[model samples]
Target: MTQYHFISGLPRAGSTLLSALLRQNPAVRAGIVSPVGSLVAAVLKDMGPDNETSLFLDEAQRAALLRGLFDSYYGALPPGTAVFDTNRGWTGRLDLLARLFPDCRVICCVRPVPWIIDSVERLIRRNVFEVSKIFGSDVGGTAYSRAELMMAPSGLIGFPLNAMKQAMHGDHSARLLLLPYDTLAEHPQETLAAVYEFCGLPPFKHDVDDIAFDAGEFDARLGTPGLHAVRPQARREVRETILPPDLWARWEGASVWRDPAFHRRVAVGGTPGADHGTAAG
Candidate 1:
């Protein structure tokens, strides 16, 4: 089995920054999001029980094939480097993934739902000249309207948030860790400590003050240029939200996942990440 993990959580919640920082470890190989998860899901469906080819394949062969796909994708990497694949799609496939890799874990990088919305909204406004790649460049509306669209049941922001909530309530919840945005943005040392503890690897000293990552080619194609870029110095919060007061109020009560009590009830890591531990419910 390959040494691999996943970095998936809410959009605009620091997954890119986290990946950039962690890869500073010479033993770790991580970067922007990968399409491996999507490809695997598609292949598995085609090879499922209904497929005519299924008759020729046994469970062992299927497992080997799946593992082969992963190893093949990362074949160019050095033999001993650990891999961390970033994708929101992983959240929806936690059960399937657990069956495939018993020891591997899915790290969910999360933030407050409202703040998550705000961050995405700010991005939308910043790229006013170009449409976002999230909604297929077809998205157009006022800030509130776009926010509403983003929070739609199937949207980029909404779906992952919902999926993560389900994972929290699932039996494999302990296999998932809710790494808060504040923890990564503010106290990266402690945050990475917890990650190393979970992954059973010794901690690597990350240059938090001089961190640098830029997925320029990918972001340019994504129509959201600078989407995954990180500055040299780390900062606590993104710029202030651009949404009006009323629209912002609507999301204030949506961050139930931020509560310590909720973490105690759901997250494997029972500590609420930030010192500000307040819950809507």
Candidate 2:
């Protein structure tokens, strides 16, 4: 009986690293972001009340159809294994997700806003020879300008933060578990321990230092090689600041997790919701 779960949150916030480590568990299947969530959304809208086909199905039928779609998508995996669906949009659709799978848990991987912005900028600068397929060839501007474009209210990297914030305040927040990027990079055992427990799974050994993931296909298409590369050990990148001093200062005080209310207290088998593994609702 395969169970469903979600992995999402801020971009460059270690979700990729987390996924790599998660796949270490033989009973767990996780990978790069999947299109299932988007497909679910499309199916729902198309079968919504306005659609003629919707009238043929009642509440139970609709529910069964949606659930079946997931089963069919992940049907190739071995039985009795838990499925983790990765997508930044999951944080934005907590309510819908909860209603769809009452027992499902959402694991959000997050990091400081300033650092998240800095990471993307660093990637852009490193790949000077190759135009980033993510930002497109016309990333035409200074490092600071590019940062602004990526952090603005409607920026590509900015939307996930806002969406996660909204879910934190939403009614279904109890199903969410927040994993700070630093924690996973610095202390993976404890981080993954809490995740497994929250999702109602028994303990399984995870070789944090023996992790590996090859994102060659998507990375090449995105024009951002090594985007999902993970080192064997969990360690933070140590290097000089690529962004200018003034530019760095722009996002100096953007660590939302620093707030007393957002403090993470995830221990083994930690409960979900605002005060525990989840963000305040």
Candidate 3:
């Protein structure tokens, strides 16, 4: 069977950056954000609306449907080439993925908790999503508006962290790789080597283009003066509201879905110090 790899993490948790870095390697062929398998199954569910019950389906039925979708989506990859799929939905389902594709490799991308929350706030101000709330959230998931619904834990990148923990404990634990967001930003080559080794791919040796932080790109704003700023710990406060009620609901409820590590940790497999990797020089 062909090998497949997934790069999963909370939104704004360096997923895109890692994907870009991985694509720079000659041994890999990453795909665009075409969530082929999951999207197809979801569309299938919508076809016969009356028979579709999102919450009522049993685990077996859901799994079967998902497996079919996976087959349809992944069966098309060109032979012998490894495909890196950077989708958040696969975070919790890594184990299931192993069952579906025994040769699959999973990478769990992590950052500090505070950084993720701050990123969400910035996205809200930029009108990325019409809502500020995330479902199953501790602070933002209160009874309010549309932004809540869209940002609801269920909607805001619904990859369950609990599922990730369970997968980590399962038989496929060796196949799963955890990556730090900060390290990838500061030393991408070292991080990329670990990923390549675990996936059974050839070593990577290339300098990637670095995009420095640009405030003007997102039209960022600072924190609120005194009131609504302190408690939520807003990083980029907004002058005017940007989130819609439904979207806010989803964003708010989506808090638990977040990985607690928003920043780099000390003893996470690799050394904390900046140990450089020579890219085949």
**Top lDDT model:** 2
TM-score of each: 0.89, 0.87, 0.58
- lDDT of each candidate versus the true structure: 0.75, 0.76, 0.52
Candidate 1 per-residue lDDT, tens place, 1-281, comes to 35878887788777888888888898887877787887888789988877998889888887778777789899888876788888887878888778777877878887767677666766677887887877678766677777787788898778888888787778777778887777777778777878888887777888889887878888878888777878786667535556576876887765657665554233334445352223322
* Ranking 2 against 3 by lDDT, winner: 2
Ordering by TM-score:
1, 2, 3
The regions of model 1 sitting more than 4 angstroms off are: 264-281
Q: How many pairs of residues collide in each model? A: 0, 0, 56
Candidate 2 C-alpha error for residue 227, in Å = 1.2
Candidate 2 lDDT over residue span 19-55, tens digit each: 8988988899999888788888898898887898788
Say which prediction, candidate 1 or candidate 3, comes out ahead on TM-score. 1
User: Using alpha carbons, what is the TM-score of model 1?
Assistant: 0.89
Indicate the residue-level lDDT of 241 in model 2.
Answer: 59
Q: Assess the local accuracy of residue 61 in candidate 3 as a C-alpha lDDT between 0 and 100.
A: 70
lDDT of 1: 0.75
Model 3 C-alpha lDDT per residue in residues 1-281, reported as the tens digit of each score: 55678876555556666665565654566633446546744754654446756556666676677666655676766667677876666756666677667778877766433334445554544453343223333333422342334334564433444445556567677766766555666666677777777778888675555422222322222221111111211022223223343433333433332333522222234632222221111
